[model samples]
Target: MNSISYFLQPDSILFNSQDIDFKMPFGATACGEEITFNILTEVSINCLDVRLILKNGKESEFKLYKKKEKKIRDRDYIVWSLHFKTPSLPKTLFYHFKFLIGNSNSIFYYGNNSLGLGGVGSIYENHPIDYQITLFYKNNPSPKWFKESIAYQIFPDRFCNANRDGKLNATKENSFIYGRWNDKPMYIKNSKGEIVRWDFFGGNLKGITQNIGYLKDLNVGTLYLNPIFEATSNHRYDTTNYHNIDPILGTLKDFKEMVRECKQRGICTILDGVFNHTGKDSIYFKDASRSTKSPFYSWYRFKEYPYDYDSWWGIKDLPCVNELEPSFFKYIVEGENSVVNHWMKTGIKGWRLDVADELPSFFIENFRYKCKKIDSDAIIIGEVWEDASNKISYGQRREYFNGKQLDSVMNYPLRTYLLNFYNGSIDSETLLKYMNSLRENYPAENYFSNYNLLSSHDVKRIKTSVKDIVKCFNIDTQLQGAAVTRVLKSLSLIQFTLPGVPVIYYGDEVGLEGGKDPDNRRTYPWGSEDSNLLKWYQKITSLRYNSKILKKGEVKFFSPHPDVFGYIRYLPNTNDFIGVISNRSPYKSKFFKLNLKELVGQFSNNITTDIYLWNESLIVPIDSSTDFPIKIPPLKTLLFSSKSV
Candidate 1:
């Protein structure tokens, strides 16, 4: 298929007419390649020459040729050709065309008809053509693994019980299992009737290693296990030892084996890096608490009594580390093959930073640099929950795109906005507000690579959010279960199709619903999966991976209304792509104009089909209006591909 396909204005069923142009990729290199743009306009009137002006400071001459038989399907376009390099340097370039009738200097403006067709044609009668072109290279792998991957987050102990041979020491206080060495520690019961159960179920690294194939079946290419470093708690966020794997999680040999196995299977491992603080029972903290003679005493800040100890947010059980101390910094980041480099050497791909906002920016920058030096592809994902660009962590501002820190941070803003919109927390106004916020704060490349999630171990599942609202407001009878399902389904469609890498948190794909923290961290309901939702999720994943535009394309938002949201994703370099239209309401929206030309390429007629659902009869063609008026169903997300409808 031709790479650059362009269309002119004032045509009904723009795609059916012979009035269009097309181009093929040419002069290719690792950095980029040029596209041979073609002209398809049919005119009896005599025309002189047609040309394209690139967004960069370069221009290409389009040569008109006789009509030929280069039809992909029922439609055929006139051919014109040109060569363009991505960019010799930095800056964005727009691709548009101009036509000279008999060399009279009267230029016909063909604006950046490169993306989609709204507001893209010439705004002025005799203006030069334009298409916004941003320069991008092909070789830079993102440093944030979590953002680019389909991560399966597991709370190690609760995932599976691998060996039935393990037993718990019932006599021990607050500990649940014995000789269960691995990620599983112990679950304890409080003296009160309340079950203070943060206990282990004997699941170990061996257990996870055994189930690598199981995760792969769910399209999980990355595994984010809760902290496995030696620590006192079952969850192990508090580190007792930074260099050694928790004895319960397995010996370093076992961990090494697991990393090897995962790498072999194309699965990346991301361990939780908890550097914000340490447990009071930690080796350094224990010695520091014991006496002043202990050399580690200087590692922590302390006063006369236990109440005077430096803690993370005043939590005495977790004492904060002194990042200002050069020795501790060396121990964690700079030691020969230390924590970060050591794990990377073991083939573990990256670190999901815990409380990154609290860690010093300088430390994170240095940490990421060291990891890159060890392996350039080693990714570092920060746990900053807000707009990372506007976020200020640790009382000082942190800049991720400055090229020294995290590859990408968790997109909390996008997650919250999606959840709130689906759950009806606020309104479309709020959704649109955050959507604009995301576009402005994140760079285009990073936006595509940002970790887009609806629910995670840290928050309630999306189903639970809507369900809880129903139960709390006593609206159970008012809104039926089917109503809630429909709403969630529509939202899921949007989440899966939108920008950024969509991630399904463990059992979320199976419709597991629970609320916040421990509740949200329930055991994966192994065999009792919700078949309908699971199938729906599979369809979503399949669609995501199938569409190049959805994976990597320029996103353009057009006329965002209170009840309807319309946007287009264009991969100007590819022949296959689509326009995504969504209606956040439960009723079919009227008087809504969805502009398709705003996409990277121009379509003479707005008729397009759903690539995945081609034979499903869901395909719809564009009307004769300049902007297509879509009769989008309530709680529906519609996708339109450029091919047959």
Candidate 2:
């Protein structure tokens, strides 16, 4: 800790990529785009020279000239800078600053902090952990509508049922339908931990069709439905056939009707593309298992053939696909009526690829090409659970954002940090650091297009995850609901305001509570929703809808207290500064005077201001000074702006 003064501090304003003075063209750079890098260091180090250590494949070095000298807090400092253009292709480049100490002629380096949280880096003697610069293709731009849209994710089997007589749709022989719509989702497994009988609540595509108006009223412009392709399980991640809708859901015609209904109401559809694997019960797999010469035999890898085959994570129910196998590749990507082409022609807006990390880059690139060829506006969002820009999978750094593979990725990093902050696993300040690193790593297009979800079918519902993170059932029912509601409100505020398309899992708006897997996929309690929570969701959604600040404004993060996370969204051309602050402590209330002048610098003293609390919006006076005292109760968040918002 005592040696902190020697570091380059990549996360601070002195080296922050988000700041124009430090890194020109900011966040993600385009191919062949000129980028400027700057670093500030104390002039007392007796530094003789500073060089940039850049690495894409083989490492290279570039010289940095001393740009200026300045006095900060009466201490002398030096600003060193260099300019370089990206290569002809997109690549993720890493860089660090190495200095030659004058008198000693010894080499010292400065780079990213140990944990890579970005802010306030450390000085290194050798082998510095570098900062990332993602270069993306200039031509890959996602649809304008998608980047600006608000999304809703529906786990088909649990969202709704449109049967007039309450009869199940094409009931399968080995599946059971819940007699009641409110029953919690439960897996019917055998002693071997294998699902013996898939269960369903009979939610169909017709259900979504019937509810299109409801989704429209919720201010949802995009509907990201979980796997709708024919799969045996309720989750539908295991695909039996790519061309047909799961019978348990509905017929192909029903799917078309749903898409049509949604389009009529101005909603886009994104279907989950689960190409990494197929169901063991699928006829293709069954036939391949029975015969060595089956046409689909080479589509999968077999350890011994017959009954032994490679499965996804050793889950025998799902047979892993050999994505690069010629036959499989042709069928999925190059076929006349290929899987991607089939759906794209049907008017669906795009695909949300399942387990995107498992699929080969070539396969994804082909998928993207096919989709774009059919409908140029189609968006391709991959399910990459971490930082997508520089993610290393299978010992290879992924080029997802290089502009050929995916339009964007699932923003699991944001979800992870936000949940950790609210759950008390991490403080607000730490969360902000992680978030800043994310924003700095990704290109603006991908960041804005990323699907931001609080809850999804794969994880616990937001309500349950926040309050019952341990998965303990000991908490009283009423107490859990209130606690969940309190945390969710603050979380929703952050989710909607961040620079991405905020997705609401089907029942999350109404306070659905469940933990993991089958538990998390609980049926939406249509009649039992908490009205207040529903209204709260609506309020946040409407606020985001009406404000351009949330959609395109630049973000500046701050933490007035360790337990509170806040940010101001502002457009450079406007005087408006939209403020959002959250107090994540369970019992500790926050009281502090927020100095707008200190944060954003020199705002008009008498700026018309409105502070919006969860229950109400009130006028807050800011006279003669750019500071105002903000007192937030425990488990709450507030929005402030120059407008009555």
Candidate 3:
């Protein structure tokens, strides 16, 4: 018996009437557009039929037409194409291509992963390939300004102190203000396992306004502040009031002034929207808890009145709201004085939906619509931990990138993958695969607009992760301070160069280090700061602002070894190209040979002799050739731009 072999070019596959000459747009599409699938194969066959296997165990056969014989890369192949109208409404369509080969009753399957480079397998030998395409109604697009800007995430309670006199206007009941600005956060719990007291460090809106110069100097275009709405807790995920700033943080006047100052500095503000839940102490929730006849009763779900009710992650202090409840929905999203509209009118540029997965798609859609209605340029981002594309929440698929819901999401997948690579838990191959999958899965616009964060209020600081490399590798020794700083610099370079808005989490630029949650939310060290780390951040951010290619260019990866990762950012119609190469290995420095032709194609020959080394701050001239080799120090990253001769 002889084994059957199949050959399919994954690069030749196309969706939604797109062709090799034009790439398909990312994310969902309108119902009326014709959806198409194209496949190319080298196997000689007179009868080849393809079917689209959908989710829920159903299949739709595609009518094959217009077969053409062609040659690509010195190989002969047959191109097969199919088309169908997209289904009406917003729903994810999971599918894979199944090809009937000849009349022999044999089949070949191709999915997203199986259609890529080096993807070949028998239908019976491997699991069927699965691909997903989301179908949705078209709506207003995200503001262009957000898609083209770099963001800075500021945890408000910890960023700065404006008065220098160290005084909080007011503190929440049972909450205490820390006298020492440098004191570490306490995660202590009481006898009943409740956080009896909350702490504040006196960082306020006035403080942020005072440092507008620092932000402008750092080239930050947007500022994403952790919730400043009236809340008892320091983190402010539990919102006590939607209409007012927390007294401890600042007053409405201070907030308005801060926004004004930030705007003058060219920095837009995005507030965190905690619409899914509110603090139990909030007026709305308190009234509901006190009486079933309360106007806000429907806003919450109670198994038995006050004591037993639904809360976010079962934390009784943060009561989860019935998002779709009429009055609640109206107040938060639909009414004339809706929270979304009110905040937008306050000069803040956008809102980042907290725990977007828990919120229904209809809710998000309405919120987005209302947001745009108020300000056409107002951006809406979601706190999605997984791949926003094709993400399923609460057993239902979400339309996050469908152009009607979220404009962008936190790029956590990239963050984790990059950290793993830098921590030596994964090599360059794995890292590239993860990053490429995201680039391929998301819509191009969303990909560029993604909030690419290296550290945030939720995760451990990148510097801490770098210094704790031994824990990642399961070793006993700790990494030294200098080595950790070097590795963090390399990671920062990659973060700023990658497609998406590079988000500098508060004090990450100045080497803030801590573990998870409360610890990650430490006060930004003022006066005392790591000068080298600050300088590196300033230089790299300046580079991003200066280079258009770094912000909006298409990226391609090329590396010679497992320890080294290299990528190029280039625009199609321009000769401008930026090259980023990093050595993740901690033990030895190595010379990396980069094949310019393989990465940049025809433009490789146009590169000038001048090469800029970011780490060394030197510009050296080299031969303008197809291949160039440069030595990279261990745990260091190198960046250079290609200039036309």
lDDT of each: 0.62, 0.82, 0.77
Candidates in order, TM-scores: namely: 0.70, 0.94, 0.91
Candidate 2 lDDT over 1-645, as tens digits, reads: 234343334322246555676778767789998988888877666678889889989899999999999776777778898989888878898888888866456777877777775655667768777888888888788888898889999989888889898778887777888888888778888898878888888888888898888787688999999998888788888888888888878898998988988898889999998889999878789889989899999988898867788999999889998999988888788888778778888899999988899999999998899888888999999999999998888998999999899888888788899888876778877888888888888888888887898888878888877776523424556666565677788888889988889999998998888898889889889889989888878888888888888888778888877899998887775677688888876667888888767665543333444433333345554442456677788778877776666
Estimate, for each residue in 376-474, the C-alpha lDDT of model 1 and write its tens digit: 877777888887754666565555544456766777777687666655675665565457546544545556667777787788877887665445433
Please give the RMSD of candidate 2 to the true structure. 3.0
Ranking by TM-score: 2, 3, 1
lDDT of 3 by residue, 521-626 (tens): 9999987788888998898888888777877788887657899998889987566788889988777898866766666765443555555445547666566566
Error of 2 at 255 (Å): 1.1
Q: Model 2, residue 303: what's the lDDT?
A: 85
| Cα misplacement distance, residue 179 of candidate 1 (Å) | 17
TM-score of 3: 0.91
Ranking of all predicted structures according to lDDT, beginning with the best and ending with the worst: 2, 3, 1
The local lDDT score (0 to 100) that residue 174 gets in candidate 2 is 79
RMSD, one per candidate, in order: 11.5, 3.0, 3.7
